[model samples]
Target: MTEIHPTAIVEDGAVIGENVRIGPYSIVGPDVKLADGVTLEAHVAVAGHTSIGAGSHIFPFASIGHKPQDLKFAGEVTELIIGANNQIREHVTMNPGTEGGGGVTRVGDNCLFMVGAHVGHDCQVGNHAILANNATLAGHVELADFVILGGLSAVRQWSRIGTGAIVGGMTGVEFDVIPYGSVIGDRARLAGLNLIGLKRKNLPREQIHALRAAYRALFENEEGTLRSRAEALAAEQSDQPLVKTVTDFILEKDDRRFCTPRSED
Candidate 1:
């Protein structure tokens, strides 16, 4: 039951799944595969080795699986794999991986990429992520589950955003953000825990309190280095899993700078 508009151009070798809709003037390349219930609205261009998962709705003017913007890309066989039930909005651009970045870009399920958002080559986006209008991720960036990037925010290359983090609008993130961290600044600085996001998940109040305590200890306590503070927190026996999530994220082996609170004094 695949439906293709009369004006659409689906290449001869394209593999379109059942109940997929290809709209007016859209182009599906030979190596592209649209899974079950995928809807490609008018003027969408899906090129390169791209396979969009089932039930994803790609809006008009979206450029999926396009060539990587990296100058080092040399026409290698790369891929962009988008997960299920994503909402890709108008003018969003998602590029495939280059040889330098393991040759594949992966986006997890239930993502909402807003208008003009860009997912750069080899970026790994986890489930329940939301990129607001004009939000951008540079090459090889990683976003964990429940991460939200506000409108006009941009994450620098190779930074990792942890689960339950919220990046504020117009912020430029140059460092790795810890889980449940709320960041906002001209250049992103740790604001606090993402309490709104945690509450939206219906997380228990005590658990959130524990996370907040851990945040203060790790970022505000003028005792030890961030990793040392995190390690000390990890040694504590706590019933709150979210606290451990933040601590473990800090303890992870990444050389990137950790986003921290601006000096209050």
Candidate 2:
């Protein structure tokens, strides 16, 4: 049985799954689909062609599935697909994709979108990602699994943050961040490997050691382009998955400059 407050307005075509609870004054639009165990606190608005997966809890004042903020959007039918068990905090705003892009904004499971966080249209957020308070992603940005954006961090449009990467508070990332990378500072230079994160995950010590060596070989090799070093590391550390992750990200072709340590210059 779904529990909907009398003050809430659930449109006729909206699909409400069992065990869902909608609080006072919340509005579920006609095209919205809320799966089982979803809890919408008061004053939340879920609109557009949005499908929020099971076990998701949305706090008050969240504006979800809104139209894209892009100027080219002309009322096209786009969608926002949020996976299961996400905790969307107060004042968070998530927009649907734009037709100019892929027409879909996808967020993976177990994400924590903190208060005032914003996910722009067409952004793809991976599982277990954490967006700290006011963290923002511009359109078409991709965040791999286990990535964390510290408070007030923002990623520029079309930039990709690889798996296990962390961007520190108040930083603006305009480049692609490598996997297991830690970046900080304004305009965000890569600080180093995410050693603490790897340790907490209990990756084998040997693998970690290999990753450290690979990092140095890839970044410290001042004689060649990053692509060349990445290719060399790929050949040398084929057995080390973590090392391969870093190298593969370097090999990815994108317009944004790769984030590198400050000392690289």
Candidate 3:
């Protein structure tokens, strides 16, 4: 049986699964569905056509699935879909999608969103990602699996944070971050591969070595253009998985700006 506090308002169309808990002064809006083992702490507001997966816990004062904050939002039928085992901390705000950006904001499983984190409309966050306290992602941001954003970091709209990348605290990211790299500061600088993170994930030593070499060739080598150096390195280290990751990252650039090291020329 579900346990709901007396002061909470669960709309008629809201579906609460077995073992779910709704706390005091919370509002579960119409068309919202909470799967089994979900819990909403006090003063939470879950609105719109939102669905929370099993074992997801939302802390107190969190506002989720609200209408997109974009000025162009026209009340279209958008949705916010959050996967299972996510830890949404206190005072967090996650908005639903907008018509301009495909109409859905999706958060994958086992992610941790710390206090005061904000995920704006149309964002797609992958599994095992961590958004630290006060980290903010603007509309249409894409965070790949295992990406970590430090406290107070802000990513601009339409930016893509690659898999395993780390954004340092208080950084302002306006471009696509390379996979396995680290970025820091206002105009973010590429601080090389996230070697420690890769090791913790059990990636082999050879792969790490290849990645370190590739990173040096692309960013540190003064021999040629980044693309040319990457191509040359790939010719010699084609078998390395890290080489492939680096090649794919360089080739995947479209309109998104990437931070490059400051050249004296």
Candidate 4:
């Protein structure tokens, strides 16, 4: 049986699964659904056509499943789909999608949205990602698996953050971050490979080494061209998984929002 506080307002059409808990003063809107073991702390509001997966916990004052803030939103039926085991901390906000940019905002499993983090409409956030305090993702953003956005960082609309990428604190990212790479500062130049993160993820030492070499070749070498270096490395280290990953990332990047290397003066 679901446990809902007396002060909580759960609309008629809302579905609350077994063992779900709705805390004091919370509101579950008409089109909302909370799966088994989901918990919403005090003052949380879940609106629109939203579904929270099992074992997810939303902290106090979090406002999720809100309508898109986009001016293009026309009261259409959009959705916010959050996967299991996500931890949404206090004051966080996640908005649903708009018709112009699909009709759903999706967040995968085992992610963490820290305090004051905001995920704008039409964003696709992958599994095991972390949005630190005040990290904001604008509409139409895509964060691949294992990506981390540090505190106060903001990613622009239509940008893609590749798998295992890390954006440093207070950075302003206007471009797509490369897979397994790190970006930092105002314009968010590519810092280097996320060595610490890769190591923590238990990637093999040989793979890490190969990736380090590939990073230097693509970003630090005299050639200063990612395509040619990536191609050569892929050919030379065909058997290595890291080399293949690098090759795939460089070749598959969408032109709109790719990270820029620092100018060599």
Candidate 5:
């Protein structure tokens, strides 16, 4: 049985699953679909063609599935697909994709969007990711699984944060962060590997050590261009899956520059 507050406005065509609870003054649009166990607290607005999966809890004042902020968007049909078990805190905003941006924004399961965090149009956020308070992701940014955006960190449009990376608070990330990388400072520069994150994941000590070695080989080697060195290192470490992930990330083509360690480090 769904529990809807008297003040809530669930449009006629909105699909509310069993055990869903919509709080006071919340609005669920006609095209919206709330899966089982969804809880929308007071003053939430779920609009557009949004589909939120099961067991997700949205706090008060969240604005989800809104129109894209892009100037090129002329009310074209787009969608926002959020997976299960997410915690969307107060004042968070998630926008739908624009026609030019593949017409969909996808968010994976178990993510946390903290207070005031904003996920822009066309962003793709992976499972177990955390966007801390006021963390902002510009349009088309891709956050791989286990990535953490610290408080007030801002990622530039089209930047990809690889798996297990961490962006420090108040930093501006303008490049693609490599797997397991840790970055800090305004106009963010890579600091080092996310050793803490790696440990938390309980990766084997040997694998962690090899990933570190692979990282240095790609970034610190001076014998040749970084790309050539990455290729060579990839071949040498072909047996190590973790090393392959790092090397493949470095070699992957993208418009954004790869995040490199600070010169002072």
Candidate 6:
């Protein structure tokens, strides 16, 4: 039982699933696919090769699956693949991928894109990610599971936000963030491990303790280079993936540097 409003324009080739609801004045393009239980409120426009997964709810005026904003885009076939149960809020814009960015922008299940949020071309967003009001990701950013970006924050292109990491409000993230890391500042700097996030996840206390110790050994110590310290730390705490995730993230080679704490902090 699909409900499409009289003023809503669903193109002939669009795929509408059972129990889907398209509200007044909405437009669904020929290539769009709305899965079962999907709801699009009034004045929404879904275009390009986009697929709204089952149980996803999109509020008013969202521009989903639009063409990539990249200056280099030139009519290539790309897709925006959104997973199930996503909540895309008002004025949010999620663009499709470009050819150079692997031809797809993929978002995992249960992500929350708050009002005025924007997901640029070729971004990869993992499950349970949260982008607070006006948070924006530049093209090609990767956000791991449970990553939280606070209000008015912006992530630089090609930056990777690791699992359970939290970016504070008004921050500008220009580099990679380790798993469970907490970063804050106008220009983002690593503050410490996301202890609260770990606790919320109900991770064992001992594991949390190991991760904290490793964090101190890597960042607080003054003996050697950060990379060397990360290597030793990773080896020492190899048994705990929680600790190793931070170390391994530090050791990985990338164009951008990992966020580090300020000298005063």
Report the candidate with higher TM-score, 3 versus 5.
5
Q: In each prediction, how many residue pairs overlap at the backbone (N, C-alpha, C within less than 3 A)? A: 0, 0, 0, 1, 0, 0
**CA lDDT, candidate 5, residue 236:** 98
Cα lDDT tens digits for candidate 5, 30-54:
9999999999999999999999999
Model 6 pairs whose backbones collide? none
Candidate 4 has an lDDT of: 0.90
**Once superposed on the true structure, which residue ranges of model 2 sit more than 4 Å away at CA?**
254-256, 263-265
Residue 106 shift from truth in candidate 4, angstroms = 0.5
Where's the lowest-lDDT run of ten residues in candidate 5?
256-265
Residue pair clashes in candidate 1: none
Candidate 5 at 188: error in angstroms? 0.7
Question: What stretches of model 3 exceed 4 Å from their correct place?
Answer: 231-236, 263-265
Candidate 3 residue pairs in clash (backbone atoms < 3 Å): none
User: For residues 1-265, could you state the per-residue lDDT of candidate 4 as single tens digits?
Assistant: 7899999999999988999999999999999999999999999999999999999999999999988899889899999999999999999999999999899999999999999999999999999999999999999999999999999999999888988999999999987777898999887999888888999989889889988887877777877456667678878888988778767777775344457577431
Q: CA shift at 37, candidate 2, in angstroms?
A: 0.7
Clashing pairs in 4: 176-257
Q: All candidates' lDDT scores?
A: 0.93, 0.93, 0.89, 0.90, 0.93, 0.92
Better of 1 and 3 by TM-score: 1
The ten-residue window of minimal lDDT in model 6 covers 256-265
Off by over 4 Å in 4: 222-224, 263-265
Question: lDDT tens digits, residues 60-117, model 6?
Answer: 9999998999999999999999999999999999999999998899999999999999
Across 1-265, the per-residue lDDT of candidate 1 in tens digits comes to 8899999999999999999999999999999999999999999999999999999999999999989999999999999999999999999999999999999999999999999999999999999999999999999999999999999999999999999999999999999999989999989999888888899999988888888888888877888677778888999935569988887777788464788996421
Q: For candidate 4, what's the RMSD?
A: 1.9
lDDT of model number 6: 0.92
